[model samples]
Target chain A: MTTTNLPAAATREALGPTLVRLQQNGANIVVVDADLGKSTSARTFRDAFPERFFTFGVAEQNMISAAGGLATLGHTVIASTFAVFAEHAFDQLRMSVAQPKLNVKVVASHGGVSTGEDGASAQSVEDYALFSSLVNFTVCVPADVVEAEAMVAAAVATPGPWYIRTGRPKIPVIYTDGPRFQVGKADMLREGTDVTIVACGLLVERSLRAAEALEASGISARVLNMGTIRPLDVAALEAAAKDTGAIVVAEEHLTHSGLGAMCAQAIAATTQPVPMEFVGVQSRYGESATWDEVLEIMGLTADGVEAAARKVVARKR
Target chain B: MVYGAQSGHIGGSMSSTEILAVLYGRIMRHDPKRPGWVERDRFIMSKGHCTPVQYATLAESGYFPVDELSTFRKKGTRLQGHSVLGKPEGVENSAGALGMGLSFGLGIRLGMRLSNIDAHVYVLMGDGEQDEGQVWEAAMAASHHRVDRLVAIIDRNGIQNDDFTAATMRTEPLDEKYRAFGWEVRAGIDGHNLEAVEEALAWARDVRGKPALVIFDTVKGKGVSFMENNPNFHGAAPSAEQFARAMEELA
Candidate 1:
């Protein structure tokens, strides 16, 4: 049932419709919103299943905690809000949802500086780091609409705590058909041997583009879409490390605690400690700009990823 | 559990004794053998530090062997220092943080409505827990949804961890707050009086359109002489001599 007619759509834009489809199919889904349903697109679900929908009216903490409560009653609870706002409810998530490993899925939108003109406060550069740090959390950031929809379905099929981050701005669709998504598995978008570019979120698109650009310059780079950050595709990572001998991690988050750090840890734990370079926000906050402009400033560009890929490739042992 | 484990919350545990007794013994529709019974009612201890009261109640209610009380706070024991679901059974949800249980109970109430299970959810909280903003948030949401199947009980024991709840945070006019939030309020029931506790609960279970709040006024340490209304026993375990004296007083 995967479609080939692709459009440039925001990952968040896919949440409501996909959620509504799942609910119609008899998924015991209860969506708890914090008054930003229109923006997060939870409104689509509200329009469909008003009775099952709950709005906590800007109380993210209550929404998050109540999702835990509802999940205990055998409902697959999906709580939606902007990424930055979701961070404020980390304690509730830790105490109520994560500690108990409840069936609560926090599908946060407007992740990273891709939120554009909203500036520093609305952007979530630390979400993957924070959510993944929790013991039972499965943090995932899809590359496009198809993956976003599939990711939501996968989360419903699976249990325990899940944090799914989606971007506000519509980005290019990389997958023409939906790809099979396993929790800890990475998808190889492009095969190579010089180096492997491990990236997550919209950075997967950038990393793919970087690989294309790298091929023209005689540097053949492999591209891996690291959608699931926690319980990372260690086997794929190990294979990439063993195959290519170098890795470059790209993400729309902080360089310190996000994708770069996870890949580094994965590589470090193995005997193969490949040379790595990070293409992300340089431990600084993002500014107000167009989505593309802000991402460029934060070094989330294809060219930036290409440069890191080459740099790491050169340092191959 | 405090005396057995040598570490646990005793004051609030002692304070909530009769309330737990009334619910586990007479009220809640539960079978110790069928703790996960779909039709059974729920009890969530929001003031989670009071772990032993509910644990002991569950044991006496036949959820587990009464002798397992000795392993209350030990490592790898299902009887955690805070309330958690399963192991001994009958625990509906894991709760340790204050102000979370009511919202949890609200979810259960709403879910029960969706599934048409027709079971009540009772959330026990501390008076000091009213200071948590999430409590007020839950209070508003419960009334907004008008989930009559959810009953919130506040063990208004007057004292909290360091001192009295009045000394720490003045939660006066508590009934008015619940009323304004559209809850049917039954304030100031004598918590130690088992008959009074049952009467208030019997009334709360039948509330028609709004969620119910039954406030029980009790002392922090109800059964012992020196520990009564004493903040020092909020979490500290008694020495052997002090334990003997407390046992004597109870006898």
Candidate 2:
């Protein structure tokens, strides 16, 4: 997966059209939005299938509950809002959808500090943790437009509750043409022996850059695009830990309970436990800033991942 | 069931007993043997804590074997403290956290329209459950979308888990609020009167252009003389002596 000549696009750009295409194919899909359909790309679905699309006008709790209600009637409901806005609907998704294993897919955009200029309130750094905490939920953070499209189709094809966080900013394409993507699986983009760099969502592109930089500095760091956060690919993680002996986990979410915390727990639970460093936001709120500035502030970049990879490799005995 | 369970919400259960009876016994088109019948009308118990009356109605309606009623609230039993979907077969939606039924019913009504299935969705709520902001949110959306055949019934027993709605959170004047939200208001009906419940439900089914709200005025505990309008009976189950007295009074 080379960086140059690859098309870059925001992850949400794929959501609505993908659903529209699926609906054309006779898929039983319902799209629910909390008055942010245009911003979240759900407007495309709403326009394509006006009868199946519903808007709750800035009320996320009702939207989620209604989505769950629709799911009970044999429709695959996809509810959309900003990631931070989803905080109000946590218990609704948890009880009505997740607990009962309903066929409701909650897809949110504007994730992380990379959601630039929207400020701290809009940036959802804790969304991954909040969604993954729910039982019977397939939590996902797509790396790029292609992965996001596949996740939407996969979520519709599968029957159960799903939580997918798509990025707001455009990033470099990481996959080849029509690459095979699966939910609850990890994609090993690069192979290395010194250390493993695991990342998700928009962080995958930066991790690839960090791996490239580390290769130039004679430090071979493997890059893994871990899209599915829950039902995590523990086997791949354990194999990576066994092979590399050190790892660096990075994401656009907080290091406290998102990818960083999951990876740490995976490493500790694995037979081949290894030293690891995390490259993500700590326990702090983000402010109004550009993507690069927010990344710099939160230490979530190629340089930050590279530095963490180096530190982890050094710590390995 | 409440006397046997020793932990069921007897007050609210007794309050909504006749309403549930009139629904299952006369109004709803549900099949006990076929809980997933496509054309059947759906009932959502949004105020989930009052499961004793709900379970009794379902069991009495033949949704499941009546003998299983004794296992209420016990370990590994299908009868949970709160209503859960698929627990006993006829249960339509899972509920416990208040103020979710209307939105859920709206979703069902919308789905029915999409599928071209002419089925009604009835959501039974509580007076105290109105305090949850999601109820108003759902109310606004249901009427805005003109979701017909979506009916909401409030068990206006006045008491909550421990106190009254007027004292805790003050969700007073529910009829005006629902009317403003664009629902047909049918207020001040006796919930314990089986005929009134039947008439209100019949009126709600014909409500076109928008959703309908039926407010039932009732006592917290309707059967037992000692527990009637008594707030202490909200969550607390009756002791053996009190249960014996209640049985004699109902008999």
Candidate 3:
């Protein structure tokens, strides 16, 4: 295919836009990848700037470790792979690399069960939990294209190593072009007082639909797009618990060690703990089904999220 | 080779001697005095067990006095069997593990590329290190990112710590393996051919859009006749007579 030579201000995919920004900014950004270039959309970078890019065949651990060495010498190395292979670089990522607080960006595409038809082995069901446990690293799961672009830019500019979980599908652009995004702050899409729904990544759209469903039933549900999962929007979470007295956490990963666990543990710190319900894959593997089927199987649909919200609200009563 | 002084990883060191010689003599962009110079290229021995050759090269290159090479393996010397971080001079990463050099080179290459600096990263690995799954991961990664500024030299000595590489675990079709991974693989060159090694180094330095892997068909103990291609010398330092004979051949 011909190269995409879009206008300077034209809209583009998250990875493309972020790469362009890095080019313009003269940032010392490098994209290291496994053999899955077509999947991760890093071919554009290779075509545009051949020198600044590196492909490490399939060595995930060495890729991460090398990224660490590069970061030590003051380069911003962006290592990309499926979330599964990226997770395989755990020991280096946790102890030998990220613990030293290296300035490396691990861009894990095909996050969650979004790699539909590739089966459960390719699907990363525990990526969020795995990355969340790493101290001092920013954990981001942008919901849509706009949010993805913002998160990628923020991740590049953010200090320390950042784990950005992105999906394979072309998600709807939920937020506007300039949707006031930050590293730790939550975006309040719709406000209500009966129940608070905190979601991130692709599930943000589902959570918004769920909130609308609850609204049709005369229930006011506050929706917060918790794009940043690690330095979790704690103030917003506390407000949700205090105002609604009930909360529901939704993501596309495992229920345990995800946003649900964070909200539950955070809310418990308060005197009036809000009853929380988690909506995600309840500790199971996925098959190579379509995206819709996988979501249906894992109960990540709007109706499913709405059901969890209802359960949490009933517990409050 | 220095008798009791060659007490750690002598065979692999001897196998890699010629490659190390060519690098220090002509290929590597290093400054003996200013080891951390910004534009200077880096050499990370990820398969670090074979540091005696590196120490020998460092001594010859004037990074330190050749007389100091005798202190190797002695207590409190900076030159340990495996490379350490605090060693004075051009030593980059403190690598003790296998299959990590390519990754370290990846980082340095990325750094040099990002800053608009003209530099390269060269990493050396052993034939047996191919067993570590992480090596293939790094190989694929380097190809995907197209980090042409990095060069990997594999010392195909055909032996590991114990037995022959083929008898222990075969890594045949080495060049095609790396080529299938998308690297610009060049193999079957003699590691001792200073001219050939120089030409390969020049080509690797100029080639862009792909990392280069040069597989040197090296003997286990290259310079010494008795120990050449012998797996028993892989990690054992030569005795006094053996060292004398090896030095006599070098002379």
Tell me the tens digit of each residue's lDDT in model 1 across B164-205. Answer: 888899988999988988999999899999899999999998
Q: How does model 3 fare in lDDT? A: 0.80
By lDDT, the best candidate is 2
Please provide, for model 2 over B1-251, each residue's C-alpha lDDT reduced to its tens digit, 9 standing for 90 to 100. 88888888999998999899998888888888888899999999999998998988898898888899999999889999998888978888889998888898899899999999998998999999999999999999998898999989999999887677788878879999999989999999999898999999889988988899899999998988999989899999899999999999999
lDDT of all predictions? 0.88, 0.90, 0.80
Which has the higher lDDT value, candidate number 1 or candidate number 2? Answer: 2
lDDT of 3 by residue, B41-143 (tens): 8888878888888888988998888887878878888787787643747777666667777777777776766677878888999989998877787787777
Cα lDDT tens digits, model 3, A198-266, are 999878888888888888899999999999998888899999989988999999988987888887888
Pairs in steric clash, model 1: none
Clashes of each: 0, 0, 25
lDDT, ranked from best to worst: 2, 1, 3
**Candidate 1: what's its TM-score on chain B?**
0.98
**Which segments of candidate 2 are over 4 A away from where they belong?**
none
Model 1 segments beyond 4 Å from truth? A1-6
| Off by more than 4 A, model 3 | A1-12, A33-39, A44-75, A88-101, A133-136, A215-220, A265-274, B1-35, B48-91, B94-97, B110-120, B133-167, B172-251
lDDT of 3 at A258: 84
TM-score of the second chain for every model = 0.98, 0.98, 0.95
Q: In angstroms, how far off is A316's CA in candidate 2?
A: 0.8
Query: Candidate 1, residues A189-225: lDDT per residue as tens digits?
Result: 8899999999988888878878888889898888888
Q: Which ten residues in a row have the lowest lDDT in candidate 1 chain A?
A: A1-10
